[model samples]
Target: MSAKSRKKNKYNFLMRMRPVLRWVLRLRSTPKAIAGGLGLGTFIAFTPTMGIQLILAVLGATFFNLNRPAAVIPVWITNPITVAPIYTFNYWLGRHIWEGPPLTEVSRQFLEIGRTMARLSFWDIKDQIIAVLSMGRDVLIPLVIGSLAIGLITGILVYLFSYRLLCIFLFRRGKKRLLNNN
Candidate 1:
């Protein structure tokens, strides 16, 4: 596609998304609830669970008494294009913080185990599964720890910022409507 066409498509897509953005920003839920929901969704997105972020976000929102839409939508921050980089960074941060084995060593051992699993007889499924889970545990433990720390910090900051912004925006909007009615 031509550069101009690509740009046009981008613009069109953004235009189409405008109403959705407006609705989210102007949701009738209390600012604190909306902000909390967004914070919860963002926290879930920081974790390594690629497929279940939305479910986690919704569950968190429901349990925490936050806005569902706000919670669910922010999880999209970790999309297909961004997942690899984000997860890689999270893993690196995890290793640094939690004292895991070196990435290279873990990767090499994982590959060796993978090859062994492939050579195993189909009847050895339990052993193969155990090997896989062992490698996964080595990686996942640190990652989960780091993600929890980062997600909590990020969630709090996002909540504070969004809460203030939402409060100001809603206050102004109410005043504007009141003026219009006067």
Candidate 2:
């Protein structure tokens, strides 16, 4: 593409993003509201359920009258690229909290078990499923607890940082307006 065309495309992209950005900036939320939104977004982002983050964020933002875009944007942090790391961290955190084996050891064992299972017959697969289902509580309990803890921590941190940044941006704009008026 020509330089001019590239520039135009860039401008167009920015223009399209402007409405969403402005919506976030114009939110009349108190600091608490902003923080709540950020925290909620972070919590939703780390949910084990996939493919529903955006919907959850929209509902949360609307219910709370928060900046919808601001609340939704941070959820992208838990997308495909970061999923493994986030889950691994959660697993390790769970292990620590539960006084269980380290995540790395569990992961190694899991891999070994998976490899063995791959060579199993269809009947064996069915048996495995039944076994897992029978003891589902053992697996699920730790997962739920760890995910909630991590989500809460992540939410608090995001809220604090975003609130501070938003405050700075608003303050700078107010200062500029005063200077212009003077």
For all candidates in order, the CA lDDT equals: 0.76, 0.67
lDDT of 2: 0.67
Where is the poorest 10-residue window by lDDT in model 2? 127-136
Distance from true location, Cα of 79 in model 1, Å: 2.4
Write model 1 residue lDDT over 52-156, tens digit each, in one string: 677788888999999999998879886645654565566677888777767776656545654664566646646744654565676878767777877888888
Per-candidate clashes come to: 0, 0
Q: Write the per-residue lDDT of candidate 2 for residues 1-182, one digit (tens) a residue.
A: 99999999999998998886566667787766776787788888775433466778889888977766667777877644465566566667776656555567555544443444455553454543443233245444555567789888888898888788778878888999999999
Largest lDDT belongs to which candidate? Answer: 1
Model 1 C-alpha RMSD vs. true structure (Å) is 7.4
Clashing residue pairs found in predicted model 1: none
Candidate 1 stretches greater than 4 Å from native: 1-20, 104-135
Model 2 pairs whose backbones collide:
none
